[model samples]
Target chain A: MQLADRIEKRRFVGRELLLWLWMESELFDGTLHTEEHGAFGFWLEKQLVLSAESESTSIKAAAPGLGREAKEALLRGQLPERFAVRISKDDEETSLVLTGDTLALRALKLATVLDKKEEAVIGDLVDELAGRTRGRKKKKAESEEDEETPFYERMSKAAEVEALLGTLYRDFLRLRLDARWDAVVVPTMRQWAAGEDVDADAYRAAKRGKSTKGAKGAKAAKGTRK
Target chain B: MSALSGSLSYSRFFVTLQGRDGTIRSAGSAADGSLPRGFLDRSYEKLLHHAMRPLDADEPESERSGWCVLGDPLDVSLPKERVYLEGFVNLGFRTDKWVIPGAMLRTRLRQAELAYREQVGREKLSRRERAELKEVVTRELRKKLVPSTRAVDLTWSLDEGLVRFFSHTASAMLSMVDLFEKTFGAKLVAESPYTLASRLRGEDDPIALDDEALWEALTPTILVPEGDA
Candidate 1:
């Protein structure tokens, strides 16, 4: 088979990964602490979009700050084709509009280090460029600075973004391709997604059909989706 | 540092490709680590030239607005590190417009009506004619006008299968993909679940991936609230 065709057959994996991520976030308080991915935080932000893989087109729903509607969409048996998600590992944070099939980061918000690193570079470059433009007069005592960071800052930040994306995506792949992933991880996630006890089948059975028993009180807490 | 101050660096995509010798490399080098000179490649320009058509259907190629690689790769990083590209593309489209102010246009129409006296006068133009005139005027004006210019920012990580482009519009994305394919003589598939999955599986696990039941099982079953179900 042609390489494109071979890959196209598996394009749904991206979507499924995204769907899995959304489910993970919704079920696990957006805290994913696998040995591989570390204690990463993921949250579906202001928007949530779901589409059937079989569907030819895509549409998005704006997830409310309170995630009742988004949860309801999950109850609707649909999966996301594209959605904006916030991912963080402690102080570092990135927001991305990740598409399912192509695993494209259609829109990306780089990690916070983006600005810190960028500003540092820009400041240094600007100082050097400024020095060159004005014949290298040494002036270390300037309190004020140009309000705009030079455009060149994007190059360095782009490198950082790519690196971080690679790391995160690899983490995801590690999680997905693990031998235990399909058999163990997903079923537990499925239970978690429904706000059920992973161990207690009876509790899940009873929780079905309008029985607000175990953690209706903690629903908002477990899934702090907004 | 602050959320409000945060701005995106660029849109990131995954590029996967296979060579003729059955070697599939997501990120391939030109052997010497140079950004594609494909902007100057005749095929790239020709493809873009046709895409940006003349403002009018009958207008010739000379009148068309199109894309050009403004210059060399905007920036090239080390011996084999990275390449940044800034592309220039022209946009041309016919517009029906009136340069005259609305009040003036109305006044002119009223005056032309008065000039008619009885039936329509020589100065009086019908709505159809006025629209036709507008098209002709706009077309002529368009010739004098330069096509709008936009700067596309792109960075290709030579070693990583990543391309970060600032523009996310469909047109820009398609253009970048086309440009990359032409430049590298390889296809760039935006790394997605499927492509990534296939790559991760490697060439050895063909049987596991190809199993129809395994593929079917991989499909998601939406576990929704039974109430909705």
Candidate 2:
């Protein structure tokens, strides 16, 4: 469904909101699952979890019916080709593992009742991760033990995990927005942009570009010519 | 002159800038250009979070020196209803030698554009021949590495007359702010606004419009708010 439509219906919940978003957003299709056994299980799995944490607080409450296969997928880190999953270690806690573009992540995050400030906070984490990796050169400054270490593990000294959790909490706020972001807001923004007085006209103009396109029709240009 | 020398890959060459307040911003490939200027704001702090460490090579540290923390990405978003690319870096900033030279910058942009066109050419179908080509391009692009939103950089410089730009990967359109800022260190000389259009059917020119005029011409659509559809 169009995110706007979904947003209006108010049917999306935490991990589901993130799952739907990660799968459908412009970036790519991926899954979210929670992994237990801590970081050890996380590494043993084939698929990588985007969030640093193994589980989120709300995983259990959202998906009471989560089965062994799904849980195993999280444990093995095996993600399907076109989906994203979030695995929480606590079975109740939830975190997302999205494989898509920035915009997709933004939408899913925004869908939850996340305020701009929280989003900005997550945006900070993204910036931090992107910055830390920039212009980095790969050389063995340490022994074989360092080589076996996961990349994130190396980042431990730099506090990458802590920073990721900060973003995770911010992301959770966004997940809740899925339950809170009213699809009605789309029309509101469109109405504001058009500077039109009528809500109906704004809604139509926003829904279909007909009004805006027609507004800029030939007559407007010809009238200016005179 | 060149990107920090070492076998740099996508992960190693990037850095995460955390605002003291808490936000995540992305900088481009080391070779592409430096981070955007918004990251340089007071709340921002740079972390050498990841670097590509070669298996067994020794390299000089000075190669990585030009790397400075730019500003946050969100703070420099495009102004409301503007057609312009936001946060372009002024090229004159390179005059100090910390930045790459304009001539070299132009060549890199040109090369990137050529590679993009060549990829399209391999299909033997013009972009217009099939509606899906755009999707293909978009999808493939999503898979590849990207440094930042817009190509090139724009920033505030002490000078008012000259514009400066640090070029990045050549995307569909080269940002006008990048062009103008690189060209003029200061604000536009004229009071009147100018239109930025492609000189040819496909080329993008900077200085097409000052910020004010561009915003007036654009109509906000669902695409902007819901994310690039």
Candidate 3:
């Protein structure tokens, strides 16, 4: 199943960092930056310029019902940092498209926080936004319906899973372990295998809080979060 | 760099927390950022009794004073004894002469961030819940984030050097005047309450220019004398 627009937009932010984390794979837990000198204007310009380097990717930053000049500036220059915004053939690409200024930086930071990339299934963000607009208009008419929907009711179970995956990614990012992929890769593979139809017993055991001990390929699971 | 002539900079501050139930406690910048013992007591002694008159304890008087400055302490009632620490810093007045020390501010903010996270560990949330919580918290932080410790508007002119200060909240301005007076030792001259009242009424009252006018104005509106009524 595909993710929604807000989730995709979040995925877009995570993707920028995820590209590096995916390649490095081993170090995806968490990453924090506390640079006080980095002004909002400075950070936005840096992320945009870096995100735009991809040849095939379309980077955009629109203020939604406002002028587009700020968005255009994000595309103008090469980023001052050494990190290249690499787009690979195997798994697609990651980048940001946003208007210039501290507001863009703030937006990017918030988007990054909300994003959980590796586990999130991708959705067409444009379609999601359109659907939301249509739903909001119609929801008012449905107010007479007895049941009330929780604020987060629309989020699927998969979205919850993806969020956990993101947290794992953030932790790895923070640890900066050289072999982080080894830490996360194997356990994720095991979980996926368990989720599959075959070896249903092993999957059930893991789900029942039995712990995935001695089920074949157990050594690979060591050191990784269960 | 030359320090400005009459400008003042507040090097440090302290806030004493007095709960509605009268549980008085204090917090301030310890030399090394650790909480000092009797902090609340000393601060209260200095600000309330020694410097400004003690705040009246009566219900009506206390209500006019202010809320519990410390706010609800880290809601320990939650599964984790979690607490959030927030304080407003007054960057010096807006004139070019005043400067906010960037390094000091960064250090304090970093400490605040670390303190918050350490108080809330991973066990506090289920794996999935923590992930969603992270996203929400991060988004909120980013939205309200300020790049530098210094957030203020600076304006300078010749006639009346009015350095109007703004901050995340009005309470932040509590020690601002004290800091200025202590460092610069400049006398604060507010218009006498009687003078202000007389001016408003278009008549000069003899009592208008006296310092006691503040106490009188604050005493509560007296009902007209029974004969006058």
Candidate 4:
């Protein structure tokens, strides 16, 4: 197929990715892990939008995914079109709305470093009050650096969030392209979405074993079984 | 959302370079160093060349769009210092369009037509005459009015090959992409699930499975079985 056709066809993968994320977030109790980032806080928050061809359901609450209507929408063949998500790692929280088809992040609010800067400003005031004198040029340079600090910090934080999302997408792809997707993940997801009890521990064990087996097979094929 | 300040909200696009043979290459491959030597100087010249031109009442063009200084739509001077900020090329995409209300235009045209007919001592005007009068009226009205202008900030990280366009509107993005490709001679691919997946998989992993086939064969999971809802 042509590149454009492939891109258009795979757009649905984004909605499925969001749906899987919502399910995993709930099943894992608002925490998900990857080899790179270990465990991080992740959950759907504030808003959730699910839609089929003609009908759509929009839910807004502290945790919209926990509502019964969200599950009902899923059962009715609606996938998440867009939803707000909150992810926290190392006490730094980032919130953004994820659009399914484009996987575009909108209104990404990164953790602010201004409070720390405020403290630093107070310290600078104290230094000035203590009669500490500095060269005019040096002081001007310092002030300029201070002005740029927050922008750089914000960009850094934003890049960090992007990297986290990239890693999460990678993990999702690994499962999605594997046999375990239909064998394990989807069955449990169906049970959970239908308001039926799902054994989280059992699912995790099965998922982990399958992944390990796949890795071993790959290693063996590479002649590195040991 | 402003790049220098305000709450962060933007759309991400991955930049790619197209070769002469029509092959698309990853931005990472092209990003060998910090935008290459004298690249900024060359880009500054291009910026000046394509800088926003305010709509002129005398001109026939009703709409125009181009780059301007970030946070200042009126300032199209695009000084290098204001645009090339610490590894990022920040600029504002500005569009100006003259919008004349239909009712107002009709009223003005009618007045012009009447005045022209009275001056020429004619009770009726031909179709061509009416068209010429309407054009004259529109130009006169444009002289008395200002074109509405919209400016959205865009920041391009030269190192990361990513562009953060502050506005998510489709038209604005399309305009920006067109302007960017024209100005920089590079293509931009908007961030999507497929593109992101391809990038995260890395460029050198030849053993990686075929993405097209994988994605094509995939089916949406049935979260709820039949009659389960």
Find the candidate with the highest TM-score and give its number.
4
Against the reference, the lDDT scores of all candidates come to 0.48, 0.27, 0.26, 0.79
Total colliding residue pairs, candidate 2: 108
In model 1, the Cα lDDT at residue B123 comes to 54
The iRMS of the candidates, in order, is 9.8, 18.1, 33.5, 4.3
Better of 2 and 4 by lDDT: 4
Alpha-carbon DockQ of candidate 2: 0.01
**Model 3 CAPRI rating:** incorrect
User: Residue B210 of candidate 2: its Cα lDDT?
Assistant: 22
DockQ of each: 0.23, 0.01, 0.01, 0.33
> Least accurate stretch of 10 residues (summed lDDT) in model 4 chain A?
A217-226
Supply candidate 4's per-residue lDDT for A197: 92
List, residue by residue over A1-226, the lDDT tens digit for candidate 2: 4423432232212223233332222111122221212231111122323221363212232332133443333233222221223332332222323321111110111111123334445655676677753221212322232333442222221223223322332332222222112232233433333333435444333333322122233234323431
Q: Give candidate 3 regions above 4 Å deviation.
A: A1-47, A51-170, A182-226, B1-34, B38-229
Q: Which number leads on DockQ? A: 4
- Model 3 lDDT per residue over B1-56, tens place: 00111111111112333444765332221223333455323433232222212222
True lDDT of residue A108, candidate 3 = 14
DockQ of 1: 0.23
Instruction: Kindly list the per-residue Cα lDDT of model 4 for residues A44-145, writing each as its tens digit.
Output: 999999998899999999999998999989999899999999998887777889888988777776666333444456766777788765444444654455
